[model samples]
Target chain A: MTDTLIVPTFDEPATEAAGRKLVIICSKGNLDMAYPGLILGAAALGEGIETHLFFTFWGLDMITTSRMENLKFTMLGNTAMHLTQAPKMPIPALMGSIPGMTGVATKMMRKQIADLEIPTVPEMLEQITQMGGHLWACRMSFDMMKLNEADLYEEVEAVISASDFMEISEGAQIIFI
Target chain B: MPTTMIAGRPIDVNDEGFLSSYDQWDEKLGAELAKLIGIDMTEAHWAPIRFLRSDYPARGETATLRRASTVGGFAIKDLFELFPGKPAKKMAYIAGLPKPKGCV
Candidate 1:
């Protein structure tokens, strides 16, 4: 039998620490809930940290321009105080016969928010992209909602699957806003 | 009450007694102070005082004038690095100065 002696290496382990990455999951449908993730992500990016905002479910409306104008901040709904007690009127669905009530509401809400010095969602998106933060739309959610790529805001980087998002999320600090 | 402004925002001197502790901040040197702080002389009159008051502990009571200029941008962190202790008092003292505002 040949005896093989195992020797341990004495050098200090040179471990490559992972770079800081933060993932923000935006799920709210209205303007008040939407700005936090965008602002924080952009600020983080400005600080030279990698940031990602993943839009899923109702949050997917954040990137879709066609649906963007229809985001409702209803008094009947549970939304931020700034948007509370606003109109929640329903629109008729007669094959485009009636103008979208939500769109009208969004415009009113946008005006109110602007008057209060709150930035709009599109403005937030512009800031986020300018600061090099990434925006990902959930592929399944987009398909389920029957949304087309043309309907989305210009800054959406990709339509990613949940698994792909998870792969990126594994080592990141994930926050659902 | 010690007070100054940066970027149009008002800042109170941190230590409660410091504003009256020192004589009125010289308004003639305000332009020079603004230049040192790297902010416009007009905009530096309010917020810098409030910010320095709120973040005074990061600056010691007697920080070198060179370190005072960094308070405008990296406001809190730079002050802490320069003063290490009693940053609030130091920042208040600097904010009270008739010297040029930012980095020379």
Candidate 2:
């Protein structure tokens, strides 16, 4: 009988104790809404953690340069005001169309971040990517929107599916914003 | 009572009822601040406070409102911002915190 020592092999060892995987899901076009996830993900990256931002649905719109530069505060389509009082309510599309509503919401959001000293979405993304955070664009959503690769920011890591996002999200702090 | 400025606005340290100065934050002051924001300075919350204190301005100087707001904003926003696909909610309460007695 041959006696041999058997050692289990794990593809990704847990050798790095301090590193963490954080995935932020951005589904809004508002700069205010976009900033927090980008900034936090960047901060996590700065701390040596592995960070990923999965842009899906409306969020895919924000990551694309074609729309980001012209991003609108679409009060005409906001569903949150009429939605149930659940914390994660959507902005009412009808209300979003109301005159001045979009501007009001936009200004309010900007002011709040100003008061809190949080960076804007463009600024946050610029810093986050420069700092090494992995950014993924949802392929299905991107396709649904008909956005081409050229429409996206230069730093986009890849256009992947939800399953890929789920696989990346495992073991990481998942933030849906 | 030491008088200081945060973001060019004067804040009285005495009215805050603690000996914390611009340089170092007193542990007791941190506890009071945590309470004012309705946060329990427990294992989960203490580290952030410690991190904030580390950014406290040195004596005879003040931290930018932009910088200090990060700490205050995170505290308020964490409790408030909760929209789907939205950033943390902004808090008006942070701006409403009582100013030092006799100093607006």
Candidate 3:
């Protein structure tokens, strides 16, 4: 059926109280970039908003079964990471390039998130899905990666074309991360 | 902590008029609620309502519209037509559950 059939057009007060819709695009796969989309999606879901997360390009990895649980943070070429970790003192790029620096940073960041009681990526994604948020994978990226649906988390509702996403996301507030 | 008398029985509800206790829900109460919300309980309506009633206690969460449509075996448009304006909220109420968390 057409979307118009489901879109509420009633004048009742209850109709006016309907929740808003949010569409988030996760284009980055880095551990740091992944949180924004997941966090915002969770927050939106918590607020009664219908939330959709579209993962594309590198972001597709964030939803992949193989990579999602093992996502890592890298300090190399990432000045923002140093700034966040030590606002006043910057770690030199050479230091970040050291072997195992990325692992160290990833561990530290994971610990911080845990200590803060923030849900880890898997937890966040699962909660979002449980709360009824929609997760979509980009069709183009899925093909480019030679990935199949089984490669991604079961929470992903579908692998959709951008045009289809646009159609589904009509009137939604879109955010790109 | 608000209560409303429906069909001569006093029932507790939240601020949004959802039944405070799942145990208090029955087909009679559901029909009463549907009437109060200007809906006529149909087979279509009962599908989601029954699904929610069973799923909530098992899963401890309300199903989203998509889930209801997909797993509950109803079209999204059918749900909208059944409840008219707010299918999710209406389904929860009719099912005698609290307003599904995260629903506006």
Task: Evaluate all candidate structures by whole-model CA lDDT and list the values in order.
Answer: 0.56, 0.53, 0.76
The residue pairs that clash in candidate 3, if any, are: A48-B102
Docking class of 2: incorrect
- Lowest lDDT 10-mer window, candidate 2 chain A? A1-10
Deviating ranges (above 4 Å) for candidate 2:
A1-16, A70-97, B1-104
Across A1-177, the per-residue lDDT of candidate 2 in tens digits comes to 112211112112221254457888988876646666766675555444677899988888678886675454545534445322466765546666678876776776666655655565665676566445788999998999888898898888899987888787888878999
Candidate topping DockQ: 3
Compared with the true structure, the alpha-carbon lDDT of candidate 3 equals 0.76
Interface RMSD, every prediction, one decimal place: 25.9, 24.8, 13.5
Which regions of candidate 1 are displaced past 4 Å?
A: A1-18, A79-109, B1-104
lDDT (tens digit, per residue) of candidate 3 on B22-77: 77779988998877766888887787899988888887777755457556777655
Candidate 2 per-residue lDDT over residues B5-28, each given as its tens digit: 433334444433233344344455
As a TM-score, model 3 comes out at 0.58
